[model samples]
Target: MTVLKAADELEEIVARVGPTAARLLTRGEEETMPEIAEALGMTEKAARARPTHYEHLDS
Candidate 1:
C-alpha cells in the first residue's frame, strides 16, 4: 500500500481537497469529527464524508 507521508502526496491532497480539508484529514485524527468540521469550516456531515470520498485515491 502507498503511504502518504511525503510532501508531494500531501500537496496532491491539498490540490484535490483544499488546504484546510487536506490538513484536517491528514493531521486532525486526534480531533473529533465536530472539531474537524469546525476547523475545516465545514458541516459535520461534510467532514465525516471527506475520508470515504478521498480514501479511494490512495489505492
Candidate 2:
C-alpha cells in the first residue's frame, strides 16, 4: 500500500470519526495513542490533532 502523509492521515481519521466522535473514542484512552499514531504513520502530535483523535503521548 502507498504511504500517506501526516496531513492526509489526519484528514482521513477526522473524516472517519469526525472531531467530536474521535474525542469520544479517545477520552481517557491514553494507552492506545502510540499504537494508533504509528498505524496512521503519524507522530503522536499530529494524530491527536485529528478532530477527536488521541490527545498526546506526553499527556
Candidate 3:
C-alpha cells in the first residue's frame, strides 16, 4: 500500500484501539497482523511495518 494509506490506517487503528493496542498490532504477534491487515485493507507486511513507517512520517 501507499505510505499515506498506511499512515491513515495506522491512525485509525490507534484512534479505535488506543496506542497500546496499536503498538501490539504492529508487532505482528498473536494474530494481530492478519487481523489488522484485514481491518485496514492492507497487507500483513504493511500492518507489521506501520509503527516504523509512522516513525519516518514524523521526521
Candidate 4:
C-alpha cells in the first residue's frame, strides 16, 4: 500500500477505537473480550482481531 493510504487507514482505526481504548486505560478496568466488543459495537471475533492488529503496528 501507498504511504498515504496506510496513514489514512491508521487514522481511521484510531478514530474508531481510540476513545474506548483511552477510556479503558484511564479507568484501569480489566475488561473481557465480550465487554470490549459490546463497548465497540463489534462482534467478539472482530474485537479479538484488534489486539493482533495493534501488535503488528507496534512491531
Reference-based TM-score of each model: 0.48, 0.47, 0.44, 0.48
Against the reference, the lDDT scores of all candidates come to 0.68, 0.65, 0.67, 0.67
Task: Write one digit per residue (lDDT tens) for candidate 4, span 1-59.
Answer: 69999999989798677666644543533457678879999997887767655444432
**Candidate 3 deviant stretches above 4 angstroms:** 1-22, 26-28, 55-59
What are the clashing pairs of model 1? Answer: none
- Model 3 TM-score on a 0 to 1 scale: 0.44
What is the per-residue lDDT of model 3 for residues 1-59, given as tens digits with 9 covering 90 to 100? 69999999988775555645555545657566687789989987887776665544332
Candidate of highest lDDT: 1
Model 3 residue 28 lDDT score: 52
lDDT, candidate 1, 1-59, per-residue tens: 35656877887865566644544566656467788789889998887778766655544
- What would the C-alpha RMSD of candidate 3 be, to one decimal place? 7.9
Candidate 1 vs candidate 2: the TM-score winner is: 1
Scored by lDDT, model 3 comes in at: 0.67
lDDT of 2: 0.65
Residue lDDT tens for model 2, 1-59: 34568778877675655645666647755887787789989998887776433333223
